[model samples]
Target: MGVATTWHGTTILGVLRDGVVAVAGDGQVTAGDVVLKHRARKIRPLFDGHVVAGFAGAVADALTLFDKFEQHLKAWDGDLRRAAVELAREWRTDRYLRRLEAQLLVGDPGQLLLLSGEGDVIEPDDGVAAIGTGGPYAAAAARALLRHTGLTAPQIARAAMQVAADLCIYTNDQVTLITVPPERQEYEADDR
Candidate 1:
């Protein structure tokens, strides 16, 4: 029997700055050495648009994880960290979920987290996280931009994805970005 081929190719970056959180993802999908699609959206808004998530790995698996994470968010009342932790635990322990090959970067107004199938829920010290084939490249660029420039979270995320696209063949320039508004804004909108 031949081995099953896994679909790949994506770069997801999340940046938190000045009370804003932005997540960006590339639109490239690859199977083996072949480029399958461009303009594939890997970033999604969750928790009544108060949270943003991006994924890197098999498309189907990531989608499933997204749904699961959303359920956790609802259960936890939109708590980003709590939802991420629950997802990570289930992804690691559940027999069916353990086979999923994907990584997630999720953020809300107050937190940025990286979730893995290995039960890891990591929050970066600098409020920046990335995953996928070009993750390292994007993450490094994001850190530099965050430190040196006064760009907003979205701008930094976009720039970082661009840098990743330029360097990684698997990553493309077509980026989908989503942002979660600050906590104060959410409260203000509720009051209005």
Candidate 2:
């Protein structure tokens, strides 16, 4: 389902704390090299159970992948990481799907992840991570927060958002977050 679609701007970030895991993304939609829309939601709740997904590519592909991923997760006894890797493998193996590139992050209570084209699921320690356009800035800020101040999950998320916003114009209305309790495999999206 694609003639051409460049109106895809998104970011995905994840952090693993001692007891909780948090993630965030920016909201911007662009076509090719032009900004087509602002305040687009890149992060979304897939199953409303406990896991969240952030995509950065064809919106259609994102939707399709997410649905399939959800189905697989449900059938697999809620294995978030394994499910995410399977999603990436499917995307990479399927020729048409390979074209609609997307990045995804799946997290549970004690783990946070970054999923990409090569089917990489990177778990950043020191609990700092980010993706999309403002990824670098957010990651940097997360590192600073982790190093300089002992902040909670919310504080780290806010700091990452602020830093990302300062570095990228798209982040002003794009800061989004989700958290999972240490003992849980699902997550809750933060409204603030």
Candidate 3:
């Protein structure tokens, strides 16, 4: 058998604070030890921009999953939790989806969830979740920032991504952040 190609690079983080939810992702895609691309956008606004989602793993696989998730969102009338659960169930059971190697972090105004191909839909108790090679570092930094500072959700997500980039060779400094503001509240403008 031929050697398996390992896809690496990417750090995705989600943080919910003060009624706002933010998801951030670093822009680096690597194949084995070689860097293939920079400025890859792994974070996307879904369901008419009512939710933000980010992914880590093979780019094609993640994109496929994103499309599937959006369909579920539409079917569920933009209910994030239901859409996430349905996606997780299908991802675990469907033959093609079961083979996908990717993880998703999705967030809306009221919820933040991590979905896996293993039939897992996890909602973090601390309102922070992360995935990919630098996930742990990002999660730790975000937790500290959430506890010690009054920064907004977007700020915490960006800062935590920066920390992960600084520590993980697989992650880069270029980040894309998307946020879903609290229900009935206007979206906050930030310098991107």
lDDT of each: 0.88, 0.68, 0.89
Winner by TM-score between candidate 3 and candidate 1: 3
lDDT per residue for candidate 3 within 66-110, as digits (tens), equals 999999999999999999999999999999999999999999989
Tell me which of candidates 1 and 2 scores higher on lDDT: 1
Rate residue 186 of model 3 by lDDT. 23
Model 1 poorest 10 in a row by lDDT: 183-192
lDDT of 1 by residue, 35-122 (tens): 9888788887898889988888877898999999999999999988989999999999999999998899999878899999999999
What is candidate 3's CA lDDT for residue 31? 88
Tally clashing residue pairs in candidate 1: 0
Best by TM-score: 3
Off by over 4 Å in 2: 1-8, 32-34, 182-192
> Considering summed lDDT, which 10 consecutive residues are worst modelled in model 2?
183-192
TM-score for each of the candidates: 0.91, 0.80, 0.92
TM-score of 3: 0.92
lDDT of prediction 3: 0.89
Compose the digit string of candidate 2's lDDT tens values, residues 1-192. Answer: 868744545656677667677766666666676776656566665556477666666677777777878987887777887787787787778777677666776776666677776767777776776777777877888888878887876568667877777777545545556566533232233422
